[model samples]
Target: MAENTCVRCGAIPPSHDVVSVASADGSFRLLCSRCFNTEMADLAEVHAFEHPEFTPVRLSDADGVVHEFHFRSLLFGDQLSLEAFEPVPGDDDYAGFRFQVLGDPRSDPFELLGNLVQKMKRALAVKHLVEDAGHLVVAETTVRGRIEWDGNERDRLPCVVI
Candidate 1:
């Protein structure tokens, strides 16, 4: 009877489940479910960009001309940036575009992507009537630069007024 330690977070009595992952050398490393799932999700995100199931998302412009954008990486943060390969008409080289999702950092990145895919599907079903609506929009105050998730307004005060 010995307590197992999670190699990733070093949690003795793990927050929840513990899983064993085999290394290349055939040794196993124990990790709590949170750490293991986070690692798996990160891998999945990488795979989605590297080997996307859907390629060349087609959306029509106001002029009804279709534009294709190849799937690219999703940069995660308070404001998520989705990069794609967009080929411009009359342009020989393929260009890149970044569609941003501002605010709502509380939402999981994967969940946001899922919601976007759902919206895209709905828009496509409607024959692309939605104009210039490729980006995900969240209702929150847009702030410039990096957002400090840990800090509060009190931390920014020079002095407390009486």
Candidate 2:
């Protein structure tokens, strides 16, 4: 069989021994272990705000009304900025944003952290969110700045708001 190549970076495929197959829907991807690790590492770095080292902080829309939400996850792709999703008030609906959030004082730090990471990943796959005309077209860190966190560090379990 012929060797495969990376669809994203155009790197030569690795030997079968060091690669893993990731499939989505009807498509299959052959990725070397290194490339796979690299991809994951990049994601981790982009969403590191959810890590234990980062604490969860919240902000309100100037009125000081506390917005209760879980920062589910984040996803980075061909877009220039990072868009985020958070649970809506008194409902399951979620909202996406292009800016970063500081840690929330009233919310549980660990829970918020976990949710933020998960939400980010989920947002990346949301067709409507990704295809929105307001979404950034060129990839750049400035488009979606890194979130700032400040709180007592603690472990937390991951959860998807949706």
Q: State every prediction's TM-score relative to the real structure.
A: 0.29, 0.25
On the 0 to 100 scale, the lDDT of residue 132 in model 1 is 48
Each model's C-alpha lDDT? 0.45, 0.39
Misplaced by over 4 Å in model 2 are 1-39, 42-54, 72-84, 96-162
Off by over 4 Å in 1: 1-54, 75-80, 89-98, 102-111, 114-162
Query: How do the residues 33-83 of candidate 2 rate in per-residue lDDT, one tens digit apiece?
Result: 345545654754533322122323444432344343332222222211122
Name the best candidate (by lDDT): 1
Clashes of each: 0, 21
Worst 10 residues of 2 by lDDT: 74-83
